[model samples]
Target chain A: MTLWLSMLGEALQAMSANKLRTFLTALGIIIGAGAVVLMVALGQGTQTAVTKSISALGSNLLIVRSGSAQQGGFRGGAGGLPTLKTSDAQALLDLTSLNTAAPVVQQGAQLVYGPNNWGTQIVGSTDAYLDIRDWTLQSGRPFTDTEMNSGMRVAILGQTVAEQLFGSADPIDQSVRIQKSPYQVIGVLAQKGQSMAGSDQDDTVLIPLVTAQRQLVGSQFKGTVSMIMAKANSAQQLASGEAQIADLLRQRHRIAEGADDDFSVTNMASIASTMAQITGMLSILLGSIAGISLLVGGIGIMNIMMVSVTERTREIGIRMAIGASRKTVLLQFLLEAVIITTTGGLIGILIGVGAALGVQRFGGIAVAITPQPILLAFGVSTLVGLFFGLYPARKASMMKPIEALRYQ
Target chain B: MSDIIRLAAIKKVYDTDAGPVPVLNGLELSIAPGEFVTIMGPSGSGKSTLMNILGCLDTPTSGEYWLDGENVASLDEDRLAEVRSRVLGFVFQGFNLLPRIDLKANVALPLVYQCVAKAKRLQRAITVLERVGLARQVNSLPPKISGGQQQRVAIARALVTQPRVILADEPTGNLDTVTGQEIMTLFQDINKESGVTMIVVTHDARVAHYARRLVYLRDGLITYDGSAADFQEALA
Candidate 1:
């Protein structure tokens, strides 16, 4: 134990004597580890952001839309037939497997309040829409079922639309013009930031379904809706809920046993898993690129160690003559190499985490600095040093005392 | 006193492209305990090879080398290192001190290999340094000291292990005449006061005179083995 301690002391002294050379030798490892840590953090942060956005869309939610239809010789794309109706949404709510259901009619409109004007999507749905989407009003009350049935000209502004038209002022009770028709703002939705597609989720307006169909979309689409948003009782029930809804829709539409259903249902869980897989691949690719730099760093260590062995040949001879064994000499050199790489690894971690935070704070990139990758990088660097230092340490230890002593 | 070093029929052959080159051939020698012996020869005369064999740094090609009762020629590399650490000390002409460390650490090097505690190692190192009149220079680096002082530090390092035999190869070759004599006088004092076996290898007859017994080698064979006074008389 004492011998090993002395060896360590000797190794440290030797490294300190050539501080500049040691730092230069360790630079490659520093850059390699730093890049690896930062890349992983960014990837993790992006994954978290994606997950947050997906959950904000609502938990265990599924969107049911009308599929394509054939009109004469022309094939109409998704939501073309408008086979979904408010009655179908109401029927889904009766299923015990589903939590709630809302009939939706969506359209883009220019919203104007006084001189402030902003283009936003206008969504028309019943009071249950807020429950399905898990959204709560920042202030004011949602439109009641009575108002929805009566086709009242009342609106609920999204956080983005409210900011554009009202700034910091209270947007409740304010009048906004949509589709050239005046409506009273009843509520302001809380901020939801961006969606997974990078579009602003809060840039929208909401109103009763009857009001949208009668006042904005006209009475031609009276009983039908563009889509139905339904929530499952639990995450595990989402698949069953989609199956039950599809089977019911097929039966209700009276499609033949061999014919295709005219509606499509999408589960949010599948989309989230796919996004997670993509981020996982991205992190692996970044980690591999950083690994190449670590390889180069190992080569640098080997090169410098070889040079050190040659420079200290006479010193090895003297130590051997005095009583140092081959093991002792090897340990000394190996310890020096480990010290260099370990120190470099520590410094790189600090710089990488700091850079990640800087990017998060100033560059607007989400970055999460976790401990797993940091420990992994540190362990890899130390192993790299040991592996690269082996050959040189062996060479130094195997020197013949006579020849080494005579070496200039 | 029993023999501390014994070599019989020792030979050393170096393999080269031209074929085997023999440096030492069938050499025989022995030294009793507490003896001060000098091996003298010109370059390539195998004196250095003989010193290396005696110091346990190298084994003969085929021979029996017994040092202090154990046959060293049969020892493995690790055992040879153990033997060297426990039983022998070496002083070289160039001082061979590590330039980066202080004199005290340099002197304590052997004890470090022995796994001695730091305080005890430094204490023994200082004690030996004082014996060589280098107590004040313990903290100084080897490069900062003069040639004579460096040689003394080397001697102190050799002594710190408290080995039975001290093997020096051209111990004062790099020093001036006065410094060389000073180092030899220190060696003579160490041998007499401690009764330690000393083997000094050098080509300088003046340095050889400091040893009590002189052995001269020529082409790997010992040509003369006698008292130092008789060897001096023969040279005169």
Candidate 2:
């Protein structure tokens, strides 16, 4: 240990002699380490954003939207056909693989409370909507079971809708007008940030399903819904849950053999997996680019170390003549390289983490600076030093004392 | 006394692109413990090659070499370095003190290589420096010191290890005549007082007079090995 410390002192002394050259050599490592750390933070941030948004929609979900409509010969787009019904959503919970299911019927409408007014999408769902989305009320209570059965006009406001119409005022007991129809706001939803489609998730309201179907929308088909959102009992059972829903819906609709599904069963896990793949690929790409920079940095260390070894050949010879062994010489040179690279790497990591925080604070881009990436970057830089320092150190150690002393 | 250093039929050949160039051929010599000897030869007489062999910097091409009762001619590179550290001390023509470090660090370096503790080695270094009549400029760098002072520091470095023999290769070559004589006198004093064996190689016969014995080399052969006083009297 004392020998190692002594060698370290020697390394530091040697490096201190050529400050400008040392800084220039270390600059490559600084930039490489900084780039690696920063890229990993950004990549992990993007991944977190995707995962958060997907999970906010609901966990292990399968959204069933009406396939299409045929009015004689003129075909309407998907969601045009009123194939899904509120009862179909409730029936899905009977399967053991499935959990809570909620029916959603949405339409864009202008809301007014006093003079302030805003246009937002109004989603109508049962009380199970909160449980399915794993959401909570910021204040007040959800519409009761009694309100659902009698088609009462109780409402719950999303965060944006509450902010727009009330503007810091208590909105729980306020009456909001949706197209000249007054509804009492009983609860307010918590902030859910943004959805995957770049739409504000909290910029809307939730009203009872019966009130939307009968009082607000008043569709020609009495019990039709636009879609049914169902969650699996567990993430592991999502596929089976999706299959169960498809089978039940097909049996109830009484479709012939080999007929197209009247309603499409879209597994949300596929979208989640696809998003994960894109972000993972992005992380690998950024990491590989950073790896290339590290490689360049390692080569730079090798170049400078080779120069140092050549310049100090006589010094090596002198030390060897006095009794320094090959291993000691090798260790001293290797330690010099490691000290340079590690010091550069430490500074680079601090700067990278600082930059990430700056971006998060000023730019509002979510950047995660986890310890895993930081630790990995440090480990990689150390390895780079050892690998690149090896060749030059070996060259120094292998020198014949006589030849080295004789070298001018 | 048993011999402190012995060489039997030492031969050295260098493989060159031109061909194998023979430097030392079938040379034989021995020096007892505490003996002070000087070797003088014209350029290419293989005097430096013989010094290198004795100092363990280079191995003999074919021969047997014994130092301090150990046959080190066939020792591996690592063991040879150990022998160099424990058995011999070297003073070079250029002082060869590490320039970046202070005088104390340079003087203590051989002991450092031997894994001596910092405080202990530095203490011994200061003691040796004081013994060489260069008392306490421990923090001064070699570049800042005069040629004579640097040579004194080199001598202190050699003495710090307290080896069995001190090898000087043109140790005073870069100094002025007065400073060279002063350094040679210091070597004489140390050899007499500490009973440490000394071998110095120089082109100047005047520097060779400090040692009690003189060996003259010519064409890889020792032409004379006898008392310095008799040799000087014969030349006169």
lDDT per model, in order? 0.90, 0.89
As for candidate 1, its clashing pairs are none
Q: Give per-residue CA lDDT, model 2, range A1-408, as digits (tens).
A: 888988987788789978998898898888888888888888889888888889888888888898776666777788877898888887887988888888988878889889999999988889888888888999999888999878887889999899989889999888989888899999999999888899999998999888888866766867888888888888899889888988999988887779777898889888998998999888878877987897799899999999989999999999899998998999999998999889988987898898888888998988888898788778888998999999999999999998988888
**Model 2 chain A: worst 10 consecutive residues (lDDT sum):** A67-76
Candidate 2, residue B73: lDDT: 87
Q: What is the TM-score of each candidate against the true structure?
A: 0.95, 0.95
True contacts kept of 1: 0.73
Using Cα atoms, each model's DockQ against the true complex is 0.75, 0.74
lDDT of 1 by residue, A1-408 (tens): 887898997788888878898899888889878887888899889888887888999888999998887666787899888888889998998887899999999988899999999999999998888988889999999998788999999999999999999999998998999978899999999888888788999999999999998877757678888999999999899889989999888988888898777889999878987888888788778777777788788889999999989999999988888888899999999999998888888888888899999999999999888998899889988998999989999999999888998899
DockQ of candidate 1 (2 decimals): 0.75
User: Candidate 2: where are CA atoms >4 Å away?
Assistant: A70-74
TM-score of chain A of 1: 0.93
Top of the candidates by DockQ: 1
